[model samples]
Target chain A: MKLPRRRPASPKKTAVGGSPEATRAALLQAATAVFVASGYEQARVRDIAERAGANVAAINYHFGSKEALYLEVLRRQASERIERYPLPDPAQSATPEAALQAALTMLLSRLLADDQRGFVPKLLMRELLAPSAALPAMVQDVIAPQFRQLSAVVTALLGPRADAATIQRCTFSLVSQCMFYLFARPLVQTLAPQTYDDGAVARLSAHIAQFSLGALRAQRELLERADA
Target chain B: MKLPRRRPASPKKTAVGGSPEATRAALLQAATAVFVASGYEQARVRDIAERAGANVAAINYHFGSKEALYLEVLRRQASERIERYPLPDPAQSATPEAALQAALTMLLSRLLADDQRGFVPKLLMRELLAPSAALPAMVQDVIAPQFRQLSAVVTALLGPRADAATIQRCTFSLVSQCMFYLFARPLVQTLAPQTYDDGAVARLSAHIAQFSLGALRAQRELLERADA
Candidate 1:
């Protein structure tokens, strides 16, 4: 949830850089919204401050500059979302299917989460679609590791004998299915509104898992046939 | 290919409304470039004119207004791209697997064709991510029909016993795999540059086809087991 809007630092407060943590939190929230809506190239510092109900001086004092503020927003949102729906360790599950399902459940829940107008995925997706200086670090720090973990889970499902290309395609296929749900939410909402109801995401996730396991089983058959 | 830039109305030619068909084509081409790069709201009419090497009046003359021009660009690009890589009729294929593969081959080819910066898919994706007035008509006229055809192919592969939900998820899984390549191209390029090389897409497409087939077969086994 948004911190109380407009918690501007008062001069009566401690010296510069002494703004309450709430004000700092508020600024990051507003920056995510502004950047997602207008993009980095077009977003203005004053607009972020206005939306946050904080003053430009507060932004300057806390984050140092607009670019610094944008990076902070990216880092904060990524860390928070990852925190909220943390990936389950495969060891926590009994089977690869269960592990994969757990990973997907966390992912779908994050993508479908509309809390704070879905600021987390929106800001992250905007960066992916339209990159900024922040993107390299974002990919390296957040995305790459998330992908590697998912890749490991996928490879586990495919078993040790699966070739690299086969593993890569299977991994990509599963991720793409999940990404489609997030990336095409607007279109899907119009096309299939019922998909968003209570427990609907879990149902959808179940279907994708079944769909994928089915495909993997079939692919294993083909590989076996080729080997024979 | 982009029409010659800035083919202004020659004074030696006819009067205002007498803009040639070539000019109209150029306007449509230029409009797509501008719209994709800047989006509909931020796109400027004057910018399209400069790119087309035509005057602003030529836009009004050929397409009536900015909204009209945008619509024309959407329609023209959709029609041309569809024309370039037309979907095959299912009747021509001998089996469901072949039919499904044919459909996916066309779809992925269209998505991966980077000629002209892969303009068609990029423009259409930008619209889908950020839909406008043109989106509904675009979906109705262009997208919905394509989906329906693909759905039919998927349903056939699913067999007559498959229910609507099963068929829908299967269809979506197949499409999501292809759409992922188009949508997350930048990320994929960074992550797996090998995927973009000659024959690489064909290999990817073959993997998706096998993956879907595997999943479908596995799903069938589940259904049979449940029945037993």
Candidate 2:
């Protein structure tokens, strides 16, 4: 049987070499892999260009610098996947739990599905540990907006009294719950040598959603308890 | 005040210029910085040695290969920190929440205290994002045993009814809660701009402890709810 075609690439960039834009897109695809493998500081433009099947000068021509290219790769990876897997339709259901779970499911599914998408988390983790000079810009342009949106969604579900600090903490907790699998894979596999396959990913996704729901529910309960 | 005297050269590797062991230690230290800055694939033995104030031959003479040196750096960092910060004494607490909170506090304190100790999370994150040839050894020797020990502690606290999967999920949640601050500092700072200092770290520590306790407590409640 033919495998399902992967999700369509985000409208932002299409196939490489199809046009001038495609060549830039191709350079980004190649750069993501190289940066994920070697990291931004060590990833060479020559290798990225070669991987993209473009001239060495193509990277500079398209992105101006290796740093610029790396930032672009981060943006493309984060923004495109998020857009492709749009947040759950809020109109579907009224409960906060339902909306929260749908949003989380979308996020987790994207994280676990695409192989090329693996580089995004890896790249972000690297920058987090040892931020490059470009990190501020990347965070401001790409990461901050996504997080702000997530916090807003979570806060709305949580209601007005949730407070900015509580909302921020909850957002961190939700993202961290999802990210543990990707960021701590080696350790997880080592700790429970039995559980690293597709089966495990399914279980993990379910558990994360359940765990998050429980936490969110508890927060709501606590608020009710306090008011009572 | 005079800076606390650097730990006198340990007998394990005196600072004598010509000793093979000293050369090996120096190379590892240098490699840690290089790897932290440039990451594994892009870090060079020459640059590492230069950072260590040693000759390039020092790496080849002691470690035999760059990959070996990288692995050794990770090993040394993990082992040294583990040795320095002994696990919390289990006898200090009776409740599972108390025991786990104690452990979490110790782990997070070490992870965020200062640059020297903080490097463990940074280095581990880099490897997680981009596994190199050396990653398996690094994980086995450094990450696994600690996680296994922590998992056991968590299992005991959660009780026998908690299956391996439940315990593992909880462990991942607990760790992610602890490590998230260090791993997501830039993003946190960018989004929350005003709250990224010691005050935030204090809030994070308290929040993680509470969050983790709530999750673990919920596990027990879930088991109770199922039985009822």
Worst 10 residues of 2 chain B by lDDT: B5-14
**Predicted candidate 2 versus true structure: per-residue lDDT over A71-166, tens digit per residue:** 777777767765666655655757666666666666666556656746656666666776777578667754565566667677876666677788
User: In angstroms, what RMSD does candidate 2 have relative to the true structure?
Assistant: 7.7
Q: Which residue pairs of candidate 2 clash?
A: none
Looking at candidate 2, what TM-score does chain B attain?
Answer: 0.79
Collision pairs in model 1: A6-A53, A214-B214, A214-B215, A215-B214, A215-B215, A218-B214, B6-B52, B6-B53, B7-B53
Give the lDDT of residue B29 in candidate 2.
72
Q: Relative to the unseen true structure, what is the C-alpha lDDT of residue A22 in candidate 2, on a scale of 0 to 100? A: 67
Distance from true location, Cα of A189 in model 1, Å: 2.3
* All-Cα superposition RMSD per candidate: 5.6, 7.7
Tens digit per residue, CA lDDT, model 2, B1-228? 443223454333224344556666677777888887777777887788876667788788778888878777777787887777777776677876677777777777766767584677677777677666666777776656556656877887666678877887888887887777767777777777775566555667677777666666677678767877
lDDT of 1 by residue, A97-213 (tens): 898888777767777777656666666566666666767776676556667777888878766677987777788887888888877766666666777788966987898888987
Model 1 chain A worst lDDT window (10 residues): A9-18
For model 1, the DockQ equals 0.59
Error of 2 at B166 (Å): 1.5
Give the alpha carbon lDDT tens digit for every residue of B3-117 in model 1: 3333454443222223477677767778888987877777999988877767889888888899998877778777878888888999999998898888888889888887766
